[model samples]
Target: MAHEVPGTELNINTTSNDQSAEVGNAGGVASAGTVQAPVGTASVSRKRQGSPLEAENPWVIDIIREATSKQIHEELKASFLRGEPDMSAATVFFAEVNQKIQKANDEHGAERDRGTIPGDAYEKLYADFKTALEKAKLERNEEAALYVVQETHSKFAKFNQEHHLPEEWNINPDAFKHDSMPEVAPKPEPQDNDSLFSGSLPDYTGSETDIPDNVSTLEELEREARYNQSLSAGEVLYWWKRGVGTQTFVQYGQGSSKTYRIRAGSYEVYDPESVPRILSSGALSGDPSSVSCQGKQKLQYRNEKGRIEEAWAYTRDQVRGIVGVGWKVDDDDEEGIEPLDLLVPEPYATYPHTRILVLWVDGAVTLEDRAFIRRITKGSYLNVARIIYHKALRQEIRYRKAERLPYEHLLDRMPTRAKEKQDIELGDEEYEQDGEELNSVEEVQPEYRGSVQASTIRSASTRPPSNHGRSRTSEVRFVEPALEPRRPTSERGTARPSPNRVPHKSVDIEDPRDAKIRWLEEQLEMSLNRNHQSSYDSSSRWRRYNRYDGRQSEVSEYTPEPRRRRRAVHRERVWDNWTGSWVTARRVY
Candidate 1:
């Protein structure tokens, strides 16, 4: 029991502690009062030096924190696993003992049967133990009360000594009270108007409380700051330029679909008993293409093992510091956890919630959502628009389920668990009989099989219907087999003429080599005859001139070699000996 502090209604058995502890419990540490570490941070004990209250009585807080932590751990574990203590047997045993005690009591210090302890003896021992436990508890509470009393008395004594009244005046209760009717104000002596500007109407032109056109109350101003668009000076224009934006957190499967608001350096210590500093911010930007960390800051958290950890603390600008080089060019795909500049404080429009708002992680916030969470007493569900930045288009696409066509949605609303075809391969088939087997499909011959060099020519032919309503069969129609046998791969030249082909007759039937010899002989003969005719004509001319004047007549300017073409000895041109006495053609080997 703790000594009660005056003027404070503090309860030691506080159940509604904090949400950071809730997050920790979800992580399996098991304390609802546990202060949460920052996102991506571990909790440590050293983080509490920043707190003045805990620094004074750390030991007391730690003791309570340990017990509560254990309690919450067990409770949450039971809740999750649905485990319960085995109390039935214990209760039954207790009842039996109580019955035995009662029976002994009814017997007046004697057992009804032999070999039994007397009721008086059993009752005395049990009652003594019970009384001792009750006494201990009572003494504890009394001690706590005594401490409270002492502290209260000491404070009052100190205060009284410092600012005490006269003993005679303060000793009596009636000293501070009115003993008689309060003295009434006496009537002023009859007098003429002594006031300045007398008989003149006072200037009351602008003193009247005339309501202004833009009359706004303090509450209305706060509502505007937190719930409505800004109505303050220059803020509306600033917001419009900033554009409407929302945030979303995607922590794999842990997203609660709830938004949060956090601030930087709220100085929340990371202890099981400390309040959690949320990992949220008021960062928003109409331009998805750009993020600005104009103002933001970082905070720290601790863990049970008492280690310090850090994370992106909080920021006012909504861009989440994406504009910072850390996010724009990190080594990894994630923009990652990095501190961003905090936003400047505003007068009234303050967001009040867990500042665990994460963009693209968990805790999504939408511009369409109310500016302030606490003031939102009523709401109608609105479409949640997710913004996707199309880098190539340099544009942001705002998409929501409500904007989709009905046909765009999938017919299967449930998740699909794909199974390999190998698993349960015959799930669809029914077993008609234990030994029955499926009919095997007909196998085609290798000849009928398609290949690179050949293909089975498919042909259709009508057949009479079977006895059934309609019948179908994959029948091979009569396709003419090729008449020509396939050429032997071993043969080098073209195929021999077909035996069925009629032979065409020609006058010459000589082998190609013999034909070549004969054709060359004929060509040589024709050339010789033409050469002989020319020679004869020249001789005739020469004889006519020379016969009349013997040797005196000179042969006209032409000379001729004695030539009858040599008998054709060879057909092809070949090289003759360079030094041969006579030039001669030789047949090619």
Candidate 2:
């Protein structure tokens, strides 16, 4: 027969009948003894035999105790291969042990309630379990060390993931191996001076020979500077003197047109040479009258004592008057044309006859013919008057104002207005005013040299008092111009006022000091309203205490509410897994 123990699963067997009878008696005695045993004593004996925690789940403690480095490595490898990120054998082993410890405590509490265990039983068991773990750690065994290393690496990998650190920052076990060491390059030898600076030095001995002579160089530089200054000032006289001149003669039967050409930067002819060529080519033979000289003749002569002289002769006064009409020379032509004689007298005097004639027609010759012509004969330069014309068109005259001699105006004792008509007939447009329409110069005002004060006083006395100070002496108050005020056409409320209407007050007319004061007052009011609104809003957002009922209310003002007691907040530095740094965690009750 086999009989089981009271609180345990162990069974005892009897071998013979006598032994069975003795066992039965002993069982009865044991049963009676167990019932009479003290609760603390029974609990102590049960603990001595085996802990209830181990009895319930023995594998948890057995795995922790019997773990090896090889087993841990295999488990870690398997876990990695299985792609289990957060789970590991070491973490599981500790978790199960902790659960077993919690269960032991719960059982100890139940035993204490049934009067089987003492009140301090759970505490004593916890202390014993902690001692065992400490003993296992202090043993310096391979499995424990490997578990620590693996746990550290696992925590580091988790920290890397949580903190978003680079993967290279994580510990790699393979990197620690001997085969993973990197090779270092050998140190270079110190270089000699010759080897360091390998290139040859430049030869600077012959540099002085490249310099030029100072006097000629300075003259050339001055010439260049003068040329550049002339260019910058746009002095056409300089270019005109430097220009080359030529002549083209086209004869059609007894009539011919002599055109002049001048080349400064470009070629400019007095008349188109192609017109004569085209007409002489028989293209216009159908109209023979178009080729008539029209009382104009081109006379060319050369005397034995004088140079070649050319002139355009007009047989009729009407023909001469028709040429170069309504044209005038610029006021600065004296400076532009006279400077060439002083600068280059030889060239100015001995230049080609054709060039001189072209210059005269172009209104560029401010001097007399004697300055440009070497010798003059009656027939050599006959019928050549001081007539100026456009450089590009022979018929368009360029008039110039006659030079006034000193005291020349004293000879004319007539009134200035009397001569204005004569000046207008002479084509003096400069004297014409812009806005005034001069229908006839004969319409002149009567000369009144009387005192202006007398006339002003008489005019002021006849006008009304309202117009006395407002009317200007220059303006006639008898007649007012007929101009109607414009009215706004739009009927909208936002229509702008008529531009002619004078506003009572304008922003442009407002005094800056008064405007600043008004602006400051408005800003002050706005700030006050803003502060009041903010206070009201903040008070509404939070709970407002009522003095009478000690409850929340809509009103912001309260009569001396009690101050809330401040609790001491416990602050501790805890490791933040996500941030991978220590942060202050606060606890308040």
Candidate 3:
């Protein structure tokens, strides 16, 4: 008799014929229905067992199907009278199911290697498995969900080992586990907005006796005491007035000894006891009008005509409509052969409010100007005074150089007035010519104006002037020997020639302008050579597009061809295998 296993297909044979019955008789337990097998002697022949996952067990199949549907129940019946399924049985069933899924993934990988599956097939499979795992989680089948997560992670690991994929492609089992757990809403935190202070408050029993008599209440007395204690050493009081924020003169030391000016709104730290008498007399005032103006007094200085003149000095603030104070050439004073064109004229009706006096004498600022400025500003505005003095000095120096004054040689390297004016006029002409070309070109294509202007300016700056059929004298002005400054004594020695200094010229022999023009021509020739070489190289590179049959071709003007007619033709060419020749069988239009 053979009895089948309850949950599996395997059968157990209890019928004994020879060896198993003799062994059962020796053991004193011989029975017709039940017989023990002898040691080392097999009674029933069973098939070789492989992995449990490879077996076609009925209970495994039923549990896997139930897990897939997420409808697992305790009283569910399995095939072949299998015992009631529990969590252990479900775990085993899911394990086998996971093995099957892995085997299917291996098949998919093989198909991918063979190029029979789509590139995203693995992705689709992963998404479907994830969906099933989520459904199991929602149905409260934790065992199936856990197995799904395990299989997904294992597949990810295999993919990483084989394909060397990025870490982002791997599945995070912890994330899914966290997602399956129940989520509790966060608790609200308590807020306290009633109190302004953080710790405990101090006790006040109204028994304090150290309060000042001037303060009426204890709070006011405490405030006064705190204010007094906050003052730094050497400071009796800090004073600041509201709304009167302009700069004002303040006297702080003993009468007429030390005094200074400070802005009104800013704080002033001083000892009031030191100047109590002055404070009592109310000498301090923030009014701008109260300050004395030293500019009202008239000062005397020698004029350019060797005569003393009286002029009133003024501070910078007193002047209105005055652009600046500097030496300027007089347009009317041109009677003398070497007329004193430079002068510091008196303030006229056009600028009547102007009062700052700028006096020039012997190609420099007069001593009277410095003395007057020092008297007006005392020592506070010396920097401003220095700046004004330098402005006047620079103007005078520039005027002298322009006029070719006798003392021009004493100055350092300076460009001649004619050379500077020529350079300026040339630059202006080049800029205007470039601008005209730029405007004309921009009329045709406005988008490329910026680039064209940049290239044009760069070329104009480096291009040498064309002198074809043009007189050199017209382009280069000749400066007379009388106008040239005398050479200094220091340059007469055997000293090395300076790179910046122009060569010394003989007084009666050669003209200096000839040498200058020759040097300029040499420089221009060198630049022209460089420009020609570069242009030749660039033209050679561009000539590649203008070649025809390996030979250079001239570019011609573009002309449109005249339109004539339109024609349509159809022809059939067939190969004659018998004659081995192509024949036109038919022609149609």
lDDT ranking, high to low:
3, 2, 1
Best by lDDT: 3
- For model 3, the superposed segments whose C-alpha errors exceed 4 Å read 1-199, 207-245, 248-291, 297-589
Error of 3 at 50 (Å): 99
Clashes of 1: 30
Q: Per-residue lDDT of 87-168 in model 1, one digit per residue for the tens?
A: 3332333344344434433333333332221224323332443354345345544344334334433443443233211111
Question: Which candidate, 1 or 3, would have the higher lDDT against the true structure?
Answer: 3
Model 3: clashing residue pairs? none
> Would you give me the overall lDDT of model 1?
0.29
- How displaced is residue 294 in candidate 3, in Å? 3.6
Runs in model 2 deviating more than 4 A are 1-63, 66-87, 109-589
List the candidate numbers ranked by TM-score, top first. 3, 2, 1
Cα lDDT for residue 41, candidate 3: 29
Better of 1 and 2 by TM-score: 2
- TM-score each candidate: 0.12, 0.14, 0.16
